[model samples]
Target chain A: MSVVARLDEARAARRQKALIAFNATTLRLGGKTIIENLDLEVRPGEFLCIVGASGCGKTTALRLAAGLYGPTSGAVTFDGEPITGPRREVAIVFQDYGKALLPWRTAAGNISLALEASRVPARERSSRIEALLRKVGLPGHADKYPTEMSGGMQQRLQIARCLAQEPTTLLMDEPFGALDAMTRQGLQDEVLSLTQTSQTTVIFVTHDLDEAIYLGDRIVGLLPHPGRIGIELAVDLPRPRDQLATREHPEFLRLRRQLFDFIKATEH
Target chain B: MNRAAILWRVASILVAAGFIAAWQLIANLRLVSPVFLPGPDRAWAALVRGFSSGDLASKLIGTLEHMAYGWLAASIAGIALGALIGSSRMMRAYVAPSLEFLRPLPVSAIIPVAIAMLGLTQGMALFVIAFGAIWPIMLATIHGFAAVEPRLYEVARSLQMSRAAVIGRIALPSALPDILAGMRLSLTVALILSVVCEILAGLDGLGQWVLLSARAFRSADLFAGVILLGATGYLTSIAVSLVEQRLLAWQTAAR
Candidate 1:
């Protein structure tokens, strides 16, 4: 075998070890099928994006991985064990930043909540909170309440709080959809770099075509009506994705076009 | 302060002065009999006399003491019961109907029953005030708890908070603004009930003082007692608002 082919094979083997797996999962809510016979694997330290039109259960899949919902059949496993409930090793960043944060807590107080939940010692919390806030581009916002921040800042605060959990995997449900285009793009890049640096596995759900392409190392598209995976594309673009060059890359454009057509067809 | 705020404060003081002037004029002109409506001078004399005689002070103290004890008891009980009812669907369902049934019953009407059971004592007056005041506190608490954002609950659960921690940290703080609002309303209700209890039971309080002065044809003393009650209510509400401000400064800063 060629040397390049051998390297590809080794990389694929490492991915197969898997950080999270949804095995033959089906979910029924109120006598209606929401998702059916779904099987997917998320590798450790990989960015996986799930994209679909509305009602395609993209968020449902993320929730399953987050252990917020239990499948009616089959099981979701994390690191080789079936997930019975939300674990400290897994944290979620929700889309509705306004509703997700405690209005009564300042930015630092909110991050402190996660630390307190994890039983981190009080003496160590201030420095950790300071570091997490700084990491999220909110260095001096400790005394500011969630209501005092802009939508993007609140979203950043949410991300910072999730990071305080120090989770191995981060599950995000359309977290950037609520922001404006510029803010969304900025956060998308921020999240990308942060996750890469932390080596954190991520399962991000979004309906935006470009967002899925821009962020995911691998993208999975789902079809509605008993939502199931319809298309899977590996993003072979090089590391450190540049906003301008990555979008201009022929591979990125090709994936974008394919996913756009797939969504257009499935949306009907 | 800003110019507008300063102007409004001046305007308020002027309006109050104008009202007193009108009251003095009306009394001087004998627009209404002094027996029915005492003038400002008569009322002021009554105030000085009552304070000097110590009749008003002891009565005021008595009324305040009863309200303080009853309100404290009701607040503790209301918050505890409301939290329980708010958190559990089963408890809320079972308890809600009975609360709804009793809620509309006039508190004044219950004073007679309290009088019969506890027999015209301070305890009876306290029982009446506590019963009357608890409903608002509990209902406001229930509303606050129910109004808590579902996403916040999910966040707490995701953080793996214990049920106790969720209640103490998340649920309680989220429900506070509403609870504090309830406490304010309940404080007024407690004051009202205290006077009503005093009047009905002939207890040694501001209400009884007013009742006796009226019976003895001393309208000035009656007017003085009424002014004192109004002042007490206003001061209590202001105190509550100050505390609410301190606790919920985060909410204000957000706005």
Candidate 2:
């Protein structure tokens, strides 16, 4: 069998297991309900996208999955175990890449942070960092600091740092929200391919409806004012989605229109 | 370097030379008494004589030693206490009021108390100097650590870093620019307090030398001592800036 076929077989086997689940999860902050009765389950290797209007607690939901925040009323679990805090097995990509990365550290040094935390031997770290940097399309730019890199490059470096963890699940909070449209499209394809090869489960949050349809196997639209799931759609677009062709696909447009109308209704 | 920089350097040199020439002219015309306001020549001659035949070298060394010891003590204590206080909201809440009250109290006001507690010894001088110098370093460290980006801590959490590692690897480096700035300010405070302590405690330093020279009406020796102190301050500050430039090379490059 081909490498891709064997990987697909492995991913199919893993899909039987639920990697992360939120059972009636509700979160309250500052005497205000941010997320109310959020019920979600992400199967292993599934690309799940949460699309919503502003104040819809999409980022907050991603935080719950990352164990950066705990649900106030219900349980958030990973691998059938309750998530009290962040584990090394899950990694996050923040939208504000500038603030997310360490300004003092070079790209290589930032990637090394994960390796160091995982207790990867110092001798093994350089090669792993180089490989991860190459994987994220940042080859030979290790010594560049975050401030020295452009916005897209910095975001790529952040992704490289996350990939260094070799995480089973990637939680992204609008990772490309700050980028230009061209860069955003490039990164969207990159993330899709990276997750495909690794079969990493992803919970990507964004307000952009087209981005949601383009990247996710399943998309969940959220309503604001005590954020909760309002619309759920299964994307039937063909595999290895192309920016132009996949977006032009009739199913993709239909899903986009549905999400757009859902968001517009939520605003009213 | 560039034309503007070279021009500025020349302007500074000209101003210094003109001031020296004006002083010489005043001394030559006896606008002021020669005993009270000697020419730059007399002061230079006295400086050379002090270093060559007099005990000024040892006095200079003594003052430097006192300042170094005090500054070192202050830096360690300040960083330790600042980190402890800054890292915890509870500790900050409990200690902040007392720190605010103590912060504004003059270092000079405590000299007599320090002298009474420790006597007129090197220990007392060291204590007074360290006490005086520690505030800037500690306060700056507190501000630096407190002002760290909240998102960095979230990143640390996501990484599953230990609490100690979070502080050491993340907070310390993040707060470094502030700490270095504080240390630079404290260095000046340390030097000033060292001189004051020496003069008060009758310790063997440039401060004592200056006090004795003034009392004995040796204006040239007094002026020489003051000039040496000024030179010491200038050189030490430059040394600190060099260190800051090296450690915070990333900050400069980011800009």
Best by DockQ: 1
List candidate 1 stretches off by more than 4 Å: A1-15
TM-score of chain A of each: 0.95, 0.93
Runs of candidate 2 with Cα error greater than 4 angstroms are: A1-15
Candidate 1, A213-252: lDDT as tens digits:
9898888999998999998877777879889999999888
Model 2 chain A — which ten-residue stretch has the worst lDDT?
A1-10
A1-268, model 2: which lDDT tens digit per residue? Answer: 4435644654464457678988999999999999999888889889999998899999999999999888899999999999999998899999999998988899999999999988899999999999999998999999988888899999999999888888999999999999999999999999999999989999999988899999998888988889999977777779999998999998888778778888888886
For model 2, the docking class works out as medium
Which pairs of residues clash in candidate 2, taking residues 3 or more apart in a chain or in different chains?
Answer: none
Q: Which pairs clash inside model 1? A: none
What are the models' TM-scores?
Answer: 0.96, 0.96
